[model samples]
Target chain A: MRYLVPLLLSTLVWWILTEAAQAWVVGVPVILVSTWVAVRLQDTDSGSAPTHRLNWFAVPRFALFFLWQSLQAGLDVAKRTLKPVPDINPGTLYYYTSIPHGTARYFFGAIVGLFPGTLCTEFSEDTDQLVLHVLDTDVDIALDCRRLEREIERLFKLPAADQQGRPA
Target chain B: MNLAFDIVLGLALLLTALGVFSSKDLFRAVVMFIAFGLLLALVWVRLDAPDLALAEAAIGAGLTGVLMIDAVAHLSANTLQNDQRDDQYDHSPKRPLWLPVISCVGLFVLLLGAIRFRPEASVSLPDMVRDNIAESGVEHPITAVLLNFRSYDTLLEIAVLLVAVVVAMALKPAAEDRVHQPPPAHDPILHGLTARLLPAMLLVGMYVLWAGSYMPGGAFQGGAILAAALVFLQLAGFAVDRYAASLLRLGLALGFLVFLTVAVSVMIGGRPFLTYPEGFAGQLIFFIEAMLTLSIGLILFSLFSQNPPHSGAVGHQGANHDQ
Candidate 1:
């Protein structure tokens, strides 16, 4: 029962990797071994770590929003760096996030760096503070971070924490 | 136009090589060396050898850079403690420039002459490979050549890798200190990236191994990707090496053992050393490659993991020290 998700995923991976039928001769053993390894690794953490449950229905919306944001941010960065004098104001901002300290918050930190002028350098779990380095400190980075946090919360269907209304 | 691009690339490659050698800071030199590897990969691509390009980029640029940076970090830390000794060592290092210049020029001339006057092979090896590729049991000529035509070479390569890894394991410092150290503080960013990227990396490694049957990918490339994924997991504070020590030892040698077993087992059927039985060649090659990928991945990861972790931390500090 513990191996179901990993086994299914590994088999799907095997199918995708080698579409040929004959490959299953070796694929079967490989998939089984891989699943065993995965299950073992998962067991290493015990029950303390939260298993992330991604809402498939929300992925498309999140991905599209992410892609658009990244494109705009990338262009903004290019413009800032390629300028004659390199117009920029760089500083750090600490974001106290409401998103819990699991995969969702971690993912939020990862993608936040891709947004225009923002880089997530550190995340303090106890404080739920995401330390961000931004190219232009003048821009309101907190607003975008809050909006993105909400987007991730929706994607994960995480229980709404009452902290969203808390001051940024 | 292509010639122009190649010439520019060639120049850039030379410049990066110079940068690597001439940089005052070891960290910068390592960075330059990485750039040199990338440019060399580009050169391989331009020469229409995507396989070499992938290997060069992954192993030469990526893995080697990390190793070298780790080494540089160790050196920096040592120098910090032995600052006076380092100054004395630096002052004593004045070798005459003309000696290297003369030797380098002589070596270049010798290489040029060798290229100009080399005799053609009596047998056209590529032609022979092309003609018999179908018999070798794989669609890709490179795969067929590697796994079938010249399998002795491949066998020896795996053996060499096994020997190298065994040596690494033997030379590693006491494991007690590392085992007792606290797990790295959980950083949401690293954990998040690992969660997302690890699966994709594993998938790509498998895809590359599978693609070797019909394209410019193979066990080596796939293995390197797998190793990179393992390294990434370790970096993210997952001590996989600690959890699966016995399994990892088996994995480290499984490919070589499997290859050797198959090679010798074939002789019992009255065929020559490595010639797979007529129709079973494809399946056998696939099986060997699958094992080889796992073994190679584990072997490479072990090499990186065997190093003391603090040496790598020192390398990080060295980068900041330079800046």
Candidate 2:
């Protein structure tokens, strides 16, 4: 019964799409046969977690935040480029994150990489620490990193201790 | 008035280019690059090349975005630590601002001169395509060119897709390490909505495929839509099968078989090569495209799978079907 829906749906789609060929009278049966053969040959069981439970409402918020940050980062880089002295103070720093799941961790790392001078170099799954490289090493830069960390924590709903960890 | 719009578009393109070059974040840079590709596609449309615009949107923006995102994911997984030297070097000696300024000026001047001093065409090829449009077997000029005038290029492009699949299969690690964690739980209403919409989405995909001959649909778009459906199923935890090796092989090879067989039979009919028999062109093309759609869908689904087929991993159990 579980397989029946998908099979019927696939067959219906295959028939409609091939209807224009004017050969559908013959083509539909061929496709159905092939589909059945394909299904039979497939491994009906593989142990991977299903991703059915997506947080739908958070998606738009995530997208908007990413867009705003991307724009801000773009402008920041442009300004640095236009400046005479370049004003670069580069340094690599280590920071810990409280995001437990791998997906959230990866998303956090990716979002951090969008800032003007920051690059997420490595994420240690065991320690939940991320190594980041920043072009500007000033005090303002540290504050900005903390701001980003807080934002990430807020978005992912991390614990307070992980959010307040020492900036390495 | 129209000139102002064109100027604005050009400036936007330039700004995007600058952003892509200057952005420190690699992922953002890639996203900007995709935006740049989209803008370029618009520029192509403005230049009266709708075909090029479509191709750029699909191949340039869509496919390239997928490839870049995959690359970024792989790079993030591999790099253990951020190098400190990158920051130290930023504080060192800086290049003169005049260098970039001079280069930009030089490039602009060269472009202006080239456009102003454009050469005149010497001769014109006979409009064989326009003249034979009625007899070309396809209603659309672009279709005629693709499947008739330059069929070989299209064939070779399909071959390239095959090679990509083969290469991915060859390089994939033998061990199936499933790293994709389950998505966070969502509202029951949203889940129910997704369930209801799945069937409708499949219908739309089919309609697009069927409409390709006369309209703006084709194997690629149809295939992508089908792949998305499959991806959705996988995400929804439906028909969780991970060891469908035989099915995978058949899906991957279906298009290649149909294309080859048709091409060879043309030779048997004493045609030069890949020439469809009169009154049969539409049928043959449709057959080939249908097969191609399946192949493309299967290949894309496989590429997006976290675990390779035959990895001996127990597939996820859920309400949806597996690809």
**Among all candidates shown, the one with the greatest DockQ:** 1
Q: What's model 2's lDDT at A10?
A: 60
Predicted candidate 2 versus true structure: per-residue lDDT over B245-321, tens digit per residue: 76887888888778888998889869977888899888788778778878877777776663333211222211111
Point to the candidate with the largest lDDT.
1
- Model 1 chain A: worst 10 consecutive residues (lDDT sum): A40-49
How big an interface RMSD has model 2? 11.0
DockQ of 2: 0.05
> What is the TM-score of each candidate's chain B when compared with the real chain B?
0.94, 0.74
What lDDT tens digits, residue by residue, belong to model 1 across residues A46-95?
Answer: 33446567787999999999999999898998898899999899998876
If you score just chain A, what TM-score does every candidate get?
0.83, 0.59
| Per-candidate RMSD, Å | 2.9, 13.1
Q: What docking class should model 2 receive? A: incorrect
Clash counts for all predictions:
1, 8
What are the per-residue Cα lDDT tens digits for candidate 1 across B106-187? Answer: 9999999999999988999889998998888899888898899999999999999999988988887787866665565454
What is the TM-score of each predicted model, taking all chains together? Answer: 0.90, 0.56
